[model samples]
Target: MSLNPSPLPDSDFTASGRRVLEVETRALQALHDRIGPDFAAACRLLLGCTGRVVCTGMGKSGHIATKIAATLASTGTPAFFLHPGEASHGDLGMVTDADVVLALSNSGESDEILTIVPALKRQGNPLVAMTGRPQSSLARLADVHLDVSVPAEACPLGLAPTSSTTASLALGDALAVALLEARGFTAEDFARSHPAGSLGRRLLLHIRDVMHTGEDVPVVAADVSTAAALLEMSRKRLGMTAVVDGDGKLCGVFTDGDLRRALDDEDTDLHATPISALMGRNPKTIGAEALAVEAAHLMEEHKISALVVVDDQRRVIGALNIHDLLRARVV
Candidate 1:
C-alpha cells in the first residue's frame, strides 16, 4: 500500500475559518427571528423591578454575564454579577427578596449554580435562565428561559464553545439595549453616568467651566491705540484682545494678524492709530451655559480659535481658546 500525503494548501485552513464566521453570523441572525413573547415578558419583569438584576454564569458564559450586568447597571437598570462558585460560599448574601437572578449555562447542569438555587428560592427571588436545552434542569425551574442554541460548534472536534457563546453574548446585548430604549434614555443621561469621559465633556461641560476669567481675559478700551492692544495681547499671552467702549460693553476684537495688515499701510501710525481701526466688528459670542462642544463648533464655523463668553448685556465675562477645548477633551 502506498501512503499519499495530503495536498490541501494553506488557503484551505482559512476556508474553514471563513465557514466558522459565516455559521456564527447566521446563528446571531436566527436569534433575531426567535425573539418572542418571552422576550417581552422578560422586559416587563425587569421594568417593574424594585431591586437589582443578579447575573450569574460559569466559565466563558460568566464573562459575558459580567459585561451584560455592567451594561444594565450603567444604563439606569440596577444590576450586579455573582459568580456561581462564590454564591455557594458567602456571596449568596448579596441576593435578596427584591433581586432577580439571571443564570447562564451551556448544559444547564453546572453544579456550582445548582447548589445555590434552593437558597435563591427561599429568599423569593425569581430566576431567569439562559441555556441551549429547554428541557434542561435549570430551564425547568426558571421563571423565564431564553433559548440560545446553535446548530453545532464551530470547532471541527465539536468540543469547544464557539457559536453558543456568541449567541449568548448577542442575546444579552439585545436585552440590555431593549431596556435602554424602553427607558427613553437620552445622551445627556448617558453623559451623567460617564461624567469622567470625553462624551461627558462634550455634553456636560459648559463654556464657563473652561474659559479664562477675571485677570486672564485680555481686555482694552475701544479707543486704545493699536500699539497698546498688542501690549495687552502679549501681557495676557492670548494673541488677541477684546475692545470695549466707554460703557464697558464689547464692541470689537483686535488680534496680532489684524495689526499686521494695518502696519503694511504707510499712513497708519502705530502709536496714534486707534484699536477700533484694526478691530473686527460683530465678533462671535457665546453664553456661559453653552456646551464647550458648541463653542468649539462656533469657533470652527467662524474660522477663529477663541470665543468671548458674554452675559445678557454682551459684556465679556470669560474667554477660551482652541487649546482649552483640546485639554478639556471637548473636541
Candidate 2:
C-alpha cells in the first residue's frame, strides 16, 4: 500500500482565488462599459426572431453559448444550443429558415464553425456573431456583430481565454435580459418556461391540478361511525376524510392526529360514535382555482397536511395533502 502527496504550492490558494475574482470583476466592468450599438442591435435582432434562437460555438465558446441559451430560454426567448462540430456532422438539419443563429468565437474564425456558415446561409438563417475579434471572418460575415473583447487575459501566459470568456458571458447575459424586457417577459412567463422549477411549479400549479378528485376523494356521512370514518381515511390513504351532512355539504373533517386525541378520551366509544362527534368543524377549505403553493402555505400556517377542497356550498370536491405538494414540486 502507498500514499503519495504532491508538493505544497509556494502561493496560498486563497490568494490565487482572490486574484481570479479580481480579474473576472475587472472583465465584467470592462464589458459593462463597452456596451454600444452592437449590443442593442443584437437584442433587436433576437427580439425580432419569429422562431427559435439557435446558439452555437466551439470549445470554451460552447460553454458560454450553452449558458446563454438557458438564460434566453428562461427569459422568454425560445432558444437552444447547437454544437458547431455536431452541426457540421449532420445535426445542422435541425436548423431551419425561421430560426436565427447566434455564433460565438473568441478569434471569430473557428474552423469547425466556419464550415457550417455556408449551410446556414443556404438555409436563409440570419447570423448574429459574438466575438472578441470584430474584424475576423465570422464577425464580418455576420448580419449583426456583438463585440465581447477584453483588454487582457487573466491567464499569466496571456493565452487561455479567461477575461475574454468572462466578457462574452456577461455580454450574453446583458443581451438576453435586454431582449427579455423588450418582449415584456414576466416572472410568470419565465415560470411557465421552467414548469419543473420551484418558482414555476409554485406559481403555476393550482389546487385542482393536484388535488384528489372524483372517486379519489375520501368522504364519510356526517353520522358515520368513528371506525367507519377511520376506515375510509385509511382506504383513501390521504390521512384525512371529509365528513358531510345530509345536504351533501361538508360539515367537518377527521384526521389521523384527531383520531389519536379522541382515543386518549377514557370514555371514547370508537365502535358506537359518529364521525361528527370527533371531527374538526369548518375545516380549512381550498378552492379549485387556488394556487397549490398557496395551499402549501396555508397548510404550513395551520400546521395541517391535508385540506378539503370545497365549492361555494362547502361540498367537498377534492382532497390534498403535503405529499401531493411534494409530488407536484411545490412543497
Candidate 3:
C-alpha cells in the first residue's frame, strides 16, 4: 500500500461528504418512521428494569453501544457497556437477573453476543435488540426488537458500517431521550451527574456557595461618613458597600461609581457627608439561595458589578461581585 496517495479534487471531496450525509439522513428518517409499538415497548422495558441496563455489542456496534450506555447513564438511566467478547470470559458474571440487556449488531448474528443470550435468558434479564435484520437470531430471541435497517450503506464499497451505525446511534439516542422524558429528568438532575461540566456549574452553584459572609461582607451604617463606607469597601475589596440602618436592614448601596460622582460635586464633603446621603437607594439585592447564574443575570440587567444578599427582612447576610463570580467560574 502506498503511504502517499493522490489527493482527490476539492469538488470530489465535497461531493463525497454530501453523499454520505444524504445517505445517513435517509437512514435516520427510516429509523424515525419505523418507531411505533416496538420503540415504546423497548422504552418500557428499560424504564421498568430494577437494575442497570447493560449494553453489549462487537466492533463498530460496540462503539455505538458504549455511547448509548453513556447517554442512558447520564440521562437518568443507570447503564454501562458490556463488551460481548469479554462477556464469555467470566465478564458474564456482571449481568444480573434484574438488569435489562440491550444488544446491538447490524446483522444480528454476532457470535459473542449470541453466546451470552442463553445465559441472559436463564437469568430472566429482559433483552432489547437493535439490529438491521429482523429475522436474524438475536432479533428473534429479543423480547423487543428495534429495527435500525438503513436503505443502503453510505460507504461507496458498501462494506463499511456507515449508514447502519448512524441509524443505530440515532435510535439509541431516541431511546435514551424517551426514557429521560418519562423519568421527568430535569437539568438539575443532569447537573448532579455532570458536576464538572459548564452546565453543572451554572445549575448547581448557588449564591450562598460563592458569597462573602460575616465580616468579609462590606457593610456600613447609613449614618456613617462617606469616608468610613469607602474604608469598608476597600477592606472587603467588593467595589461597593451596603448601607444599613441601625437595625441592620439594608437602606441602600454606595459604590465606586457613586464616589466618582460625589468627587465631581464641589459642595460634597466626603469626610462629613453621611453614606445614606451619597448612597443609591433601592439597590438590587438577591437571596443567598438563588443560583449563581441568576446573580450574573441580575448584575448584567442592572449594569452593576456587585450585589448584596439579603433575607426576607432585608438584612444583609452576604455580598458578592463580578470578580467573585469569575473566580467561582459561575460567569
Q: After superposition, how far is residue 199 of candidate 3 from its true place, in Å?
A: 2.2
lDDT of 1 by residue, 174-283 (tens): 88889989999888988898999888779999888999999999999988888888999988877688999888799998876687788788999979988998899888
User: How do the candidates rank by lDDT, highest first?
Assistant: 3, 2, 1
State how far residue 80 of model 1 sits from its true place (Å): 1.1
lDDT of 2 by residue, 184-214 (tens): 8887888888777789888999898999998
> All models: lDDT?
0.88, 0.90, 0.96
Q: Which stretches of candidate 3 lie over 4 Å from their true place?
A: none
> Which pairs of residues have clashing backbones in candidate 3?
none
Candidate 3's displacement at residue 213, Å, is: 0.9
TM-score, cand. 3: 0.96
TM-score per model over all chains = 0.90, 0.78, 0.96
Q: Top TM-score: which candidate number?
A: 3
lDDT of 3 by residue, 24-96 (tens): 9999888889999999999999999999999999999999999999999999999999999999999999988
Q: Give the clashing pairs for model 1.
A: none
